[model samples]
Target: MSRNGQAFERYQKINDLFNRRKGEMAVVTTEEILQKFEISERQWRTDKQKLEELGAKFEYDGRLRGWRYIEPFNFSDNIPLTLEDMYNLRLAVATLAQLNHIADFKDLPQTVNKIRKAVGRWVDHEAQHKAIYFDPLPQYEGSRHLPFFLDAIEKEQQVQFDYFSFQAHQPQNYRFDPYFLRQHHQRWYVGGWSHDPNEGFIRTFPLERIEGEPIRTGKYIDFACKPKGFNPITYWQHVIGINRPARGLVEAVVLRFNRVQGKYFESQPFFQPYTILERTEDKLVVQMDLMIEIELIRKIASYGHEVLVLAPATLVEVMRSFFAKAAEQYTPR
Candidate 1:
């Protein structure tokens, strides 16, 4: 290992020691550290000094006979990164650069350039080689409003905008208390509490459907109206995709996929609450606890003949109807 690699390894070891002692009254003595690393006392002192320089503060406890952190710190934040770490970061920056075409990520290319310059000193010229490439994402509208919605959510403010739903002949004005922004299937959707007369519940609005920029209402969020203990992060825990049906209840959705398609589900699951009930040479049966929603239907239909809905009579009937309609489109007239 190089000098930088050795330094990173030693810092990682020290970090592990501190993490093990976290939330406990126990302390790790300098002798113990030195013995573990097989380093001299002088070298250990130097290491401690370097760590302190990197925002880690430690003091020797006379009564405890060991060193204790004076403040919360993460050694990795300031320590030299290994070559592999630098390479991986470079790859990530490259990947981020590909998203520059998106309005919300327009600054990514500049940020990637900044990172390349910062790491130029440690990395070789070969780092500039485009060794990996990502498929270009299709340009989708409505990403430009991401920053505005993010700001509104952060400030706990209400916003007003004009939205044109597919069913509506004209755009309709709406007042909403922005809660969170979610990206699904390359499109952006903002989930929030709607203040419209007919829709007074939490709902999501697709950004592309929004006619123009949303203006802040100059009013703070109505905390009283928000459901108690409702977390935006876990709001869709039982639902698939972004939409949560108005009266949908969580159900056990069982599916059987052919061996080939089963491998795909096994390697890359689509839902969080996923479990494999049975596996055979010809088929794979999996169950997911989720709400019956449009996204779930779309996902199941996407697998076509490769997958079969095995449980939840309602879902099975829904799938049958969906396939029947789809098959009718291809039927000879």
Candidate 2:
């Protein structure tokens, strides 16, 4: 058989295993697998892996002499939805409704609608609407281009688009292999590999400022163009928001917040690798190990007198300069 033929046979075997598993009540016995599938244990293991890749949960039971789904599988009857499940569904519907743009996600909106119709009688619409609400963010002008970028990422293709650079005071053309899309503070951002300025570096662009349309360039040969050890998740792990951190090693930042502010931090700690060094009646001292980016500086400064920079003198100076500039802007010349 040809390569395509072999692939098709494998797919058929995996599908057959899925159907058999779906029918079984308590577990799928080894005898059933051997008689129906007529495959060796190793081949069965391979088929199991393929099923798992397709999101089918299964586990082997020695005493039962069979495999069972991690969660009970019931295809015929409707699974009972608890009040908590209804609440989550409500939030899902609300969030999907907010994304007015992007026509590709039509099925998601429809699914949310179906969920609402199914659970309408049980769930309290008005109370849940008030209690769990996702605040709307600024609508992106070029949000229609989201599909094009997503396609490029899926297919490992390069894309071209016109972007408005605030610093340059003009629109510039960009061509790069689309990597990942991230949402921060209700804003969308795309991170990718670009070779415009130098050899190449991973960079991020705000989706809102992405002007014109995204043109699919071509397929990206990952090995040749991309850096050997580049992983977007690891690259942006230590930083906050979309902006790159201050050019240096990640530092340990200690801050003291007043009682009111400390209470807020205690409730919702922002950065990861966070630790509360000391807590007292007067203030709360917390430490976070992360890159000292401009966004981080602004966040700390936003607290004004409530937050004080205890360590990392450089960040403290940045904070001081930030406040001084603000004061100067207000002072008469």
TM-score of each: 0.78, 0.74
> What do the candidate models score in CA lDDT, each in turn?
0.85, 0.74
Residues 52-80, candidate 2: write the lDDT tens digits: 66556787778768887775433323334
Clashes of each: 0, 0
Model 2 TM-score on a 0 to 1 scale: 0.74
Query: Candidate 1, clashing residue pairs?
Result: none
Report the C-alpha lDDT of model 1 over 87-183, residue by residue, as the tens digit: 7887887778767899878778788888777778544664555577777788888988989999998989999999999999999999899888998
Segments of candidate 2 deviating more than 4 angstroms: 1-27, 30-77, 101-108, 123-131, 221-224, 246-248
- Clashing residue pairs, candidate 2? none
Residue 101, candidate 2: how far off, in angstroms?
5.7
